[model samples]
Target: MTLIDEGTAYGRQRQSHDAEIAEVGAGTPGGEFMRRYWHPIALSAKVDATPQNVRILGEDLVLFRDRKGRPGLLYPRCAHRGTTLFYGRVEDEGIRCCYHGWLFDVKGNCLDQPCEPENGRHKDKVRQPWYPVEELYGLVWAYMGPPNKKPVLTRWDTLESVKPGQKIVATGSSQGAGGDDTVEIVPTNWLNDWENIMDPFHVPILHTTFSGVQFVPEMGVMPEVTWETASHGMRYIAYRKLEDGRELDRITQALFPHTRIVPDIRLIEGPAAGVGWVVPVDDTHFRLFHARKVPEDFKPIEVRHYEGRKWSELTDAEKQMRPGDWEAQVGQGPISLHSEDHLVSSDQGVASLRRLLREQIRTVAQGGDPLGVTFDPARAVVKVQAGNYYRKK
Candidate 1:
C-alpha cells in the first residue's frame, strides 16, 4: 500500500571523530596537530608592501613585507585597540598600526608606541600575536605552533633537482592574482583534498570511467596499488598494465600534514614537478601552491579548461557530463562524515592515512614530537621518492 504523502527528515547529528578531525582552531586537536608543521601561507612573489588578508588554521592573519624585504604574518587585529592591521602601513622597520602609529617587527616585537611617550616603557611589555614565517622554493611558509617547538623548514629534493638551465616556476592563485591555469580556494576541508591523493582507484573511474579521458591515456587502465609508510608520510606505488605489453609504475607521495607530490596529469615528457602543498585556509576552505622546475625559456603549460571555460562557468549538464575531481571531492559535503563511510579493501590507503594522522595527534598530545620535525638545519633536506617508471616489454 502506497502512502498519500511521505517525507524524510535530515538530522544534524555529528560524530566525535568528525569533530576531532574537522575542527582546526588553536585549541582544537586537529589544529594543534597540524600547527606542529610548517604550512604554505603565500607565494614569495606575492608578498609585498600591500598587506594581504590570510586565514589559516581557523585564525585570521595579515601577511605583508616591510620596505626592507622581510615577510611577516601577524594577527590582523592591533594589540592596542583591536583595529585590523590590514590598513597598517609597511615601514622599513616593520608594520605600523594606522590607528595609533604602534610599530611591530616581523617577529611581533613592539618597536615603537607613538601614543605612549617617554620612550614608551610599556611598549616592551606588549607584543602582537605573530607566527614564524620563512620562504623557500618561491613560497612563504609559516609555523603557527609553539616557538620552542618550531621545526626546520624542509627543502625537498624535487625542488632542488633542477638542471643548471632550468628554474622553478611558482604558479598558483594567491591573494586574488596569479597564473590563469592555477587552482583557487577550494570549498572543502583540507582532508578531503588530501585523501584523494591516496585513493588511486578514483583515477580510472572519475577521470576516465565517467568522463571520456581527463588524464593520461595510461591512467584509463585501472591500477593495482600498494601503500607503504615513508619517514615523513606515506606513498602509493601503483602498477598499470598497458596495451604495449609494458607495465607502468607510478609512485605518488603525501608528505605529513599537507604536501602532496602528484604526477603530471597528461604524462610528463620532461622532469616531474616538485612537491606541492595542500594548505588549509581554514576548516571549510583550502588552497593549492605548486612549484615546478622548467627550462628558462619554457612557457606556462596549458591545461584543459573544459572547452576554454573555467570550472565555475560550466553549466550543470556540462559538469555532469565531464565530472572532474573538483566535483567528486567537493561533492563529499565539505568535511565528509567519516563515521558514515564503510571501509573496504580498496580504502586501505585512506584508512592508513587516518590512522597515521591520529597517531601524530596522539603523539602531540603526549608531549612528543611528531614525524619529520627537526631543529637541525643540516638534516632538513628531504629526498622525496615519487615518479613514473615504464617497464620494457
Candidate 2:
C-alpha cells in the first residue's frame, strides 16, 4: 500500500479534541460545554477584603466583595476607563476602578464615576460585564453561562461533611493540587489536565508507582467504575467497591465541565483532599483553583511546591523517594493524543467517561436535557469510585 494509505490503515481514530468538540481550553467545543455552568473562579483566600484579578475559562474576572459583604464577579476591565480592577479600590459599595474612578457593585451596575459630575448620577447608564458569584466551601464560584441558566450554589456530602475544625484548605496550584498557595499555569491545552479527572487508572502509575509507592498496596487494586452525563458539559464517574472487604470503600468525585474531589491516598481513616478548576486560560493552557479537606490529624499536609518531589520531574532515585502528580495526567500532553492510546479493561472508567461525554454533546446538539441539568434541590451525597488502583503488569 502507498504511504498515505498505509498510514491511514494503521492510524487510530481521533477523539473529540480532533473535531470541533475537541478544544484544549477556552474557545473549544469542550470549553463551550464547560461554560454552561458555575465554575470555581478563585480561592476564597485570594479575594478577601481586596479586589483580586482572576481568570477562568479564558475570561479575566475580578472577585471582590461590596460594602454589604456581598461577593461580586466581574470582567477585570472597568467600563469607565478600561482600567484593571486588580488595582481598583475596594469600598463598602463595591470596587472602584482606579483609572476613571468608576464604581461598580457585585451586580455590575456602575454606581459612581468621579469623572462624571452630578454626584455620578449617570453611573447607572453604564454597565460593567459582571457575573453572579457565590461562596461555597470557602471558594468563590462564578457562572459564565447564560444568566437564565445560572444554577444554584451546591455541595455534596463530602464537602458538607467538612466542619470548621475539620481540614478544609484551598489549593495553591493554578488548577489546585500541588501543596502551594500560588496558581500554576500550563503551557499546553486545558483539556489535557481537565480530563485527567476521569482517568482514574493513571493514579496508580503516575502518582503511585510512577514515583515509587505513593499509595498503599490496599489502595492499588483497580475497581469497577462507570461514567454518566451531568448538567452543562459535566461528566461524573462512579468507582464501585473493590474485591477486598477490609479496606474501607471510597469514591473520588469529578464534575464536568471541570472540577474534582481529589482523592487523598494518604488517608489512614477518612478522605484526603478536594480540588476544582477555574476556567481555561486558552486552548493550549489553563489554570486551576482547588481546596483540600484532610482529616483532623493528618500531620498538616507537609507537602509544598518543591520542597518535596513532584510527580512530573524526578530522577529515578528522586522519583523512587517521591510521589508524583506531574505524570499523573497532564503528561497525556498539553492535550492528549487519543489516537496514541490503547484502552483495556482497567481503563473502562475512562472509556465510559468519554462515551458519556460524547453522548451528552449529542444530547445538547439535539436540544435534549443532559444529566445533572436540573437543580438537585436536596443537595444529595455524590459518590463516585475514585482513588488508588492497579492492573496486573
Candidate 3:
C-alpha cells in the first residue's frame, strides 16, 4: 500500500451517537423519558408577579406566581389567538392574556373571557396548556408528563432522614456560595454533566493529579473502583490505599432521571449530605440544582467556583491552567459523540450509566415507570448510600 496522509483524505466524517440520550425535545426518546419525572424548572424565588420565560424538554413556557402567590407554569402562548403569555397580566385568580383578557388558573383552566359574549361557548371550551408545578426546597418543580402517570416528588432520605440537630439547607441557584440564592446556568448538554457523576477515575486525574490539588491531598492518589446497580439507581465504590496503613473507601450514588448523591463538596469523610441534579434546559443547555443538609456543629460547604471566581470571570489562560469539570465536559462539544469515544476499562461506570439510561428510556416507551419512580409519597423516600469511610489495615 502507498503511503498516505489520512488528514488529506476526502469525505472524513464524524459519526453520530446517543441521540436517544442527548435529545430532549418532545417525542424523542430522551425527551419522553425525562418527562416521566418531576424536574426543577426554576428557583422558587425567581418566579414573581411578572411572568418569567422558562423552557424545558424543548417546550417554550412561562412560569409566574399570581397576586395571591399561587405559582403557575403555562404554555407561553395564550389559547386565544396564540398570543404569548409573557405579556399577560397576573391576576388574583389567574394570569390574564393581554390580547383579549383570557384568564387561566394554575391548572390551565380558562377562567374568564372579557371580550367574549356572556354565554360564549368559546370561553368555556378554551383552556391554556399548563403543567403541574410544586414549590419544594426553594425550587419550582414541574411535572411535564402524562397527567395520570405523574409520580410524587421525592423528599430523598438524605434530606429527610437527617438526625437531630441536622437541618436542610436549600440552595436556590447552582452557582453561589454555600448558602447563596443565585445559580449559574451551564452551557452544555444535560447528559455531559450527569455522566460525570459516575466517572470516578477522573477524580484523581482531573481534579487532583493534573489539576494540581483542587481537592484534599488524600484524593490525589489513584483509586480502584467497582460499580453496582441500586434500587433507585447505581452506586460505585472506590478504594484508595493511603500512605498509612488505612484505606479510604468512597461510595457515590447516581440516581435515575438526573440526581446524584455524592460526597459533600467540602471533601468531608462521611455520608453524602447533598442532593444534586442536572436539569435539562433543552438539548444543548442545562443547569444544576442542589440541596444539602448541614450538621448543627459543622459549617456548610460552599459550591465550587474556580479560584474564587465565577466561571464567566475566569480568563481563557486561567481556565487552561486549572481546568475544572465544566471546562472538561463542555469541551466535548454540546452533545458528545459516543461513536467517536474510545472507551476503556476505566469507563465501566460511564458505560453502565449510559446503558441504564437507555434501558429506562426503553421502559418508558413501553408505557412503564422508569427505575426509582413511585406514585406513592410514602414509598418515595429513597434510601441512598454514598459516603467516605476509612478502615485500618
lDDT winner, 2 or 3? 3
What are the TM-scores, per candidate, against the unseen true structure?
0.92, 0.75, 0.91
Better lDDT candidate (1, 2): 1
- State which candidate, 1 or 2, has the greater TM-score: 1
Which 10 successive residues of model 3 have the least lDDT summed? 174-183
Per-residue lDDT tens digits for candidate 1, residues 1-393, read 987654544554565337676667898888888889998888899899999999888899999999999999999999999999999999998999999989999989999987776757889898999998998888898999998999999888778888889999875552111113445787778888787788999888887877567666788888999999999889998888888788778888887887788776665532356677878888877888888777889886554446766656678798788777777767777778788789899999998988888888878878989888889999998887788777644
Residue 289, model 1: lDDT of 80
lDDT of 3 by residue, 1-393 (tens): 998776864786767868988889989988989999999877777789899898787898999999999999999978878989999999899898898888899889988887767734576677788999998777889999989989999877777777899776665454521112343566678888888888988888887765566667777778889999988779899888888767878899888899977785445677888888888888887878877787777774443445776555667897787777777887888888888898899998899999999999999999889987799888978775898877654
- For model 3 the local lDDT of residue 201 reads 85
lDDT score at residue 146, model 1, on the 0-100 scale: 92
Model 1 local distance difference test score? 0.81
- lDDT for model 2: 0.60
